[model samples]
Target: MPPTRVGAMRRRGLFVSGAIQRMRHGPAPGRWILLIGVSLVLGVALRWCGLPAGFLLGPMIAAIALSVAGGAVAVPRVPFQLSQAVIGCLIARTITLPILTEIGAQWPVFLGGVFSVIAVSLIIGWLLTKWQVLPGPTAIWGVSPGAAVAMTLMSSAYGADARLVAFMQYTRVVIVASAASILAAVLAPSADGGGAGSWWPSSVAGRGGTLLVVAVGFVVARLLRTPAGPLLAAIVIAALAQDLLGLKLELPLPLLAVSFAFVGWGIGMRFTRSTLSHAVRALPAVIASILILVLVCGGIAVLLVVFAGVAPLTAYLATSPGGADTVAIIASSTHVDVAYIMAMQLARFFAVMLTGPFLARMLTRWSGYHAADRA
Candidate 1:
């Protein structure tokens, strides 16, 4: 062979050897770089397209694709925990004094709405479990109307399949967000055009305080070693500090993006070929259950309108089953009672967080009993 041909052949052999080595030893650091790059591109695209939780969803989808294709890469434990803590803080920051005051003024109405939505979700989850649509408490967690990311993280702690739960949760988020946006447009067409605020923190002290809170939460979670401990701890600490101490919690856009990417990658990289196949098969049942929950919540909204005398649009948005962030966006743009809507959303969120584990255990026991009876 000519010198040029020999060099080309040698280069090709080296490439093949490297490929084989990577397969045996798992992906290289370059795989991580590639994953991050792809995740960023997709995240930005999805966000531009107006998908709720697009950044997280984009990374998750990218990770799933890579994992299923055998390019599996795992997020580091520390980063994942910190990301969870950041997400917890994000949730806590939503609970402002205005939202709390709204809930306080009509505690009964808020209580009714919260429990009503929770009860409906439980019923739908139970039906899915009884029908054997998904395994164990996965269906229950999947159908829970809490914040999608929070539910997905907490579900893993309860021994449910996080991959499946993530799938179900995000699917519902997309549907609910889209439906809510459409309804808002139709019902309140005149009320549009609220722009997003700045993504950067206004003051260094606020950012530092928020980081300090996250650190404390990280330590507490490390000591507790509970499932999703970081997330739960951060939420409690940040919420109390914000609501009671009048401290401002600030999370810059870059910090949030990184944290969301970490979470998205962590969950996504865990998906195996079997898991992906299982999720595909379960999609129909999941969609049906989500729709049922949405419809039931709509009925609850009607009750709010008739009895509580909330505006029709506000009631609908407030009683939305999932996608609190998306609902907030719509509520902000529209001429709805934003405070009341957020209050109801936050109320349902806290209620789910408190009762989720108990409900999971109950569902597990009930599933076992039902299975035994059938056997």
Candidate 2:
């Protein structure tokens, strides 16, 4: 073509090549930094918009996107424990003498509801095993409707596949969390704009006392090796101090948001390609099982609302098939009775811990017996 046109094209090519080379050798930001920075920005934006569980959900979604895009990222266990401590302390603040009395008064309803949910879980577990949807012991442990960590830990002792148990448990957690956030939005859409934590406490005595309580809780939890030890210890200690010493402790909203982000990161970072593939393959069966559990729990909640005259929100939160700390966070966000919901979850947690192993072993025997009969 023309000489001037050819020179222009050559210059354009050189410019493009220079840009590519710079990109290859440039001081680009680390992938981890980009991932974290992006997640924080998106999460805070969502929180500002007043979405239900926005901080947690926003970070979780961002992390999931990065993980799927092959980003090398990880969340340490210490952050997970710290997140639990933040939530645990928040929940403990909601407990009171009146709420404790209410729980005692409603003991019959609470016990019946807990037992019914366990029975439903057991039946679902059997169906999954019977249909070969999941392995017998994994199904048994997975469908226990207890704390995921506790159930996963219990699975090994009962000869269940820990990996499968963990997979199922976390699946339920994700589903329940997503559903609860949607429900919270539908039920309570208003923003609550108070109670941010301060770096400096209002009083020196208050700061010292609260710090002492938290320190003791962590130390005690570590010694015990309890599942979710930090949370359990914090809740128990904070609750006792509130009742006995009339002490009140509060975490600033900013700190609480950070804890939520940490928790979301911990969960999302667990989603490797292999795990994601297996989850997709098993999605239909797992979704069906979890949906059935949710429906059954919802029916129980409705019954409590009608027969026991409990508040609808309280009933629903009480029977929610998520973790206790999760239930507390959702309940608090929705302005519900955190103590009552927590009480119900605590009851279920203890019951599962007590009966899960025995039941899993029994189910294993039943499965073997049935297989032998078929043979």
Candidate 3:
């Protein structure tokens, strides 16, 4: 046991400990760092390309490509979709009763004082089952054309398939939104603004209000656990408030559109790649459900022209059963009765959300359907 032997043992022990530590930690543990770097580079590239006005249709197509290329992400269902109803109804300050009340006045002029349009919706809804087009409740919700999120919630509650309902609605949105410009271009009378609608809640919030609302919305959205819905709601609401006051915010359109894209990405990521893959196989059924909806709602619009004495074009946009933002924009640009269109649309949205679930439960004949998960 000499000093030289003791030094040799100590050196061996040090080597052993170092080797074990290296084994535990491994190399390149910062995977997310690399992902962030790549995402950042992509973002900058996108911003710099200078996409032409109303050129978002291309970018959206690109995003879909990226999501598919990135591969399917599998995980438990996320929580935020459930919160969309709450976020839609309450997060935005502009969804006030005053605006809604004013919008309601047009229902008489459009739906008839006897609620003929809604009655039509109900009858059309029943026929969907007759045609084997959709689950009864979902058909009703699909044809409803109200608030998409609200309808989703109602379907969830009444025991319809929330995911299917959401997927169907989202599909229709993509279809209408994707084709909006094309349709407008084809259908627009040259003298009538060429079917290019004005941005609704036309007042853009100035720098100060925009920043303030963005900050407040970010904080509240984080706190409320409504990741995307609240933030988007903030943009919509604050801008709306500014418009109502006649001092609109003047933020650049590109910035707002980008914000919307990010929000959409977050929501799109919720259903793991697998959920969407399954949805892909079921695309025919999903597409069928939405087609039925478009037909029924479109028919309702045509009938309103006859029964309520509203113009066919005006009622067509009003009853188009598309997204609130999309329809709102159409109404504003076309100089349609924005108030009435929004009122009926919003009510339908809420109706779909709150009541869709129970109605789904009432349909007991479906083979794979359920009452609780509602999806």
Candidate achieving the largest TM-score: 2
Off by over 4 Å in 1: 1-28, 91-94, 129-142, 147-202, 243-246, 279-281, 302-375
In candidate 1, list every pair of residues with a backbone clash.
none
**Each model's lDDT:** 0.75, 0.75, 0.48
Ranking by lDDT: 1, 2, 3
- Runs with alpha carbons beyond 4 Å of true place in candidate 2: 1-31, 193-204, 369-375
Error of 2 at 235 (Å): 0.4
Ordered by TM-score, highest first, the candidates read: 2, 1, 3
Residue 187's lDDT within candidate 3 is 45
Candidate 2 local lDDT, 1-375, one digit each (tens): 999999999999999767544533444345456556767787767657665666676677766766665663667777677677777777888889998998899889989989998999898887777677775567878877857888987787666667677777877776777787777767765365212356545666655666677677777888898887888888899889888888868576776777777777766665556656656666688889899998899899999999999888778878988777666666767767778888888889888988888887787677663434321
**Top lDDT model:** 1
Query: Model 3: per-residue lDDT, tens digit, 1-375?
Result: 999999999999999767534532333333223323334454445334322112233333433433444432221223223222222222233444565665466545544422433455455555564454555456555554445555666565554556666666666665655444344334432222212322343444444565556555555666665323453555455646654764334334344344333333333333344435646655776666556656666677777788777666556666666665555433433434555565566555545455545544443344334344233
Question: Which pairs, if any, clash in model 2?
Answer: 197-252, 197-253
Per-residue C-alpha lDDT of model 1 across residues 1-375, encoded as one tens digit per residue: 899999999999999778645653465586776688789898777566554455666787788777777778767999888977876776677667776676688889888988999988888887777777787778989988866767888887776778898878766775786687567656865321222223787988878889988999999999987656777788779989988887788877677778777877876776667666769888889888888889999999999999999899889988998655445545654566766786688678778888988987797677663434422
Task: Output the lDDT of residue 95, model 2.
Answer: 86
TM-score of each: 0.69, 0.85, 0.57
Question: Candidate 2: deviation at residue 77, Å?
Answer: 2.4
Per-prediction backbone clash count: 0, 2, 22
lDDT of 3 at 264: 38
- How accurate locally is residue 293 in candidate 3, as Cα lDDT from 0 to 100? 58
